[model samples]
Target: MDPYAWSWNPEGLVVLLLAAGYVAALRRYPTPWWRPACFGVAMVLLLAVSVSPLHMLAMQYLLTVHLFQNVVLAEWAPLLVVLGLPPALAAAIARPSAMRLLTHPALALPVWLANYMIWHLPWVYDTALEHPSSLLHLEHALYFLTGLALWWSVVQDAPHELRAGTRAAVVFGAFVLVSPIGLVMALIPRAIYGFYVDAPKRLWGLSALQDQQLAGVLMALEQAVVFFAILAFWFARFFAEEDRREEIDRSPEAA
Candidate 1:
């Protein structure tokens, strides 16, 4: 709870340095200012959730806070970072043989889903908490990375570029698969994580079970916002494209 004691982890340092380097590169490449700004804000958010008092709060006090961190890092941060990339840079990144393979939904979906489920397993979760030095960071990194790869398949290619129907399916499918985890967490009467049960956390005088359930509710709510927004956007784009194609087909030149 000592907000003064902010963490300065190597991962935070790396994220900052990469953002710095990317901003500098923008000068040479002449990319849009908003692009770097998106990246910069994403990095700041990364530091906040992972390295600030928020980090301590999650690590020691509240499971709900940790869940929030995971969603922000995995879902929000990666999506914004991908959106921030210049088209050329995005294309370059996507052009690689291995990158292409990993970004494909066939490979990305199960990896992301597994990464998510495995980390929640009781033993695995406890081990991560036990080893703050390595495994914890690994867990966070996996969350961010698998999310990045997952979002890459969605955002890097525009809605019109990809099969909009397929993109919608992936997003909706993820929503369905991930919601059960949250629902399970919320409905369970008992606490799940051992560390959070008695750990110096009495925020709002809430019990561990209450805190855990709140986390689940937040996760479920967050998934709805994220996935549904993406779905709405894709469907809108899909229908717009359809309308345009129909217009072209009915044009006088077509006759």
Candidate 2:
């Protein structure tokens, strides 16, 4: 099987697009020095792992490589992109009309959860690995988009949005909802996907089982970090709002 035999082309194109999007976002946002630079480093690392020759080379021989690919795709990349905020691009694309659509209570949350469930199914996951190029491309795009929506509702500095407590509950609730998927991945006895079973093993001397364990660890860590970070921010905002309300209450006009 020619690993590069157009099977990887779509993923390559996706990597290019993500890089371009990152650059475009930076140009539009004028992000603070620290945030943009950090985001850039994360993006570069993620692209290198996902689409660069190094990733292809690793994919040829290692379950660890496959595990790394999953982690980079589903965890690291989303987290970094969320932290970047990409507010400028989001704002540009999110016209008042689009914002209305995205903010629609009837539309956003269900699509978000549906996308999450569809992608992580074992059949869907195996299909992507089997096809390697097209399915994987679609999978990555959906993963990134769903992640963006999830984080946007919880973290983006937007106006007239869910209150901080609600945001915290949403983030934490997502973490809990996804926990079963992680456990499924961890507990499945036999290799569910043929791709990993056939792939060469390298890096950290991990077997298929160990590689799967690592994937579970990555997923769990990602969930924990995202949930806790949102919770902390939510609490801080909540307290700040309370303090402001108290100050207003104590003002001379109120007295």
Candidate 3:
């Protein structure tokens, strides 16, 4: 199959169904323009990665493409999806006891970290590729789901929105925890994923190991940029909150 040709899968249908459901839900709740905007972009990203030529390249030709796809699924798409939720909807969802417990930073952070690391293990990664019928879908599903779980506390104004200081800590901690995987993938002497190493004559005249290294470097850099950007936002919010509290404390009414 031509690596650049567009391919449609059940995944595209899934994205559309999600969009449809979201649209239906919006009729009942007043939503800000930005909420739908975030959701629309996320669905577009999900659909593009599922149906565009990029999906083909990831499935067949390049680990770099596949890693890029994973990053979108696990990081970019999920963050936007969470951001897209209306605050009323988010509060409703968070009201569930189970969701409240699961989204707690104590649990969400570790689950996301483990999910991120476990899927990248060479044997696991290679097996998912080899058996795309079953495991590949599972892999993608978990990435998206856990990503929702991961970002829920950070983005949602829900049952327990994290304090700005705590949110900054969680984002920074995740950045630190996940950095090692990318570093290992980049610095390792060889391509660890056998399926990629064994793929047909590599495109762009690149060997498997070189492609793997590039994927690793890109992944690390992407994480650093995304995480630090969020960290800065949260830190700013933290400082602002601190200033507000200090101002109230110094007010004559309090005195």
Candidate 4:
């Protein structure tokens, strides 16, 4: 594949079709407009980074682009998917005690962290790149799945799920745990991924070390954006819930 030009991925076509099918199902059993809207945005983001020319750039040219792509898939897309999940579907998920436990911080956090670290290891990273024909799609799928699990504990609205306070702690602690990987990547002066060392630069004037640093900054900045947004939401929600309870407490005595 030409690193600079548009390319048709069979997988991309399959994904687009599947996304369309999902949307059609949502229409048949529609929730609110916002649910489909969130889902549509997720699909667009998935296609933008995974199927578009951006994927080519990441695969062939820059580690920065690769990390950015992963961030979009892992962090951004899955969150939207969570928001878009139908109430009916969520209700079904509420039944299984074991499955519910999977979303707890203890389980979900470690699974996400382990899968993420495993993929980033030097040899694992290189091997995935080396077998782009096979392993690359699996790599992206793993990131997206782990991401879904990571956010599940924190984002669920079901009564069976973690309380808002616990969810907030889980998400914040995850940021503290995961941010260092990006920091190390951004602060390093030398190239960390040997795969890109001799690769030809396609668009940017960046050298390999610069590309790695850019990837790191992307990792750090994106995590900051997503984590802080969620935290702000939790803060407001926690205060609002507390105020509501106090208001009820202060209501006039009833017969």
Best by TM-score: 3
Structural similarity to truth (TM-score) of each candidate: 0.92, 0.77, 0.97, 0.89
lDDT of each residue in 1-255, candidate 1, tens digit only: 573368778778878887887777666566778877887788888988878888888877888888888888778888888878877777767887888888888887889888888888767877798798899999999988998888888877722246777777778877888788788889988998887876764776778999999999999998998899999998887788889888988997877
Q: Model 2: what TM-score?
A: 0.77
- Compose the digit string of candidate 2's lDDT tens values, residues 18-58: 66877776765777666666566667766776666556744
TM-score of 3: 0.97
Which regions of candidate 2 deviate over 4 angstroms?
1-10, 17-29, 57-68, 85-89, 103-110, 200-205, 252-254
Cα error of candidate 2 at position 161, Å: 3.3
Worst 10 residues of 3 by lDDT: 153-162
Off by over 4 Å in 3: 252-255
Say which prediction, candidate 1 or candidate 3, comes out ahead on lDDT.
3
Error of 3 at 3 (Å): 0.7
Ranking by lDDT: 3, 1, 4, 2
lDDT of 3 at 129: 90
True-structure RMSD, every candidate: 2.2, 3.9, 1.2, 2.4
Ordered from best to worst TM-score, the candidate numbers read 3, 1, 4, 2
| Cα-based lDDT for every prediction | 0.82, 0.64, 0.90, 0.79
Which numbered prediction scores highest in lDDT against the true structure? 3
Worst 10 residues of 1 by lDDT: 158-167
* Over 4 Å off, model 4: 93-98, 248-255
Tens digit per residue, CA lDDT, model 3, 109-142: 8998899899999999999999877998899998
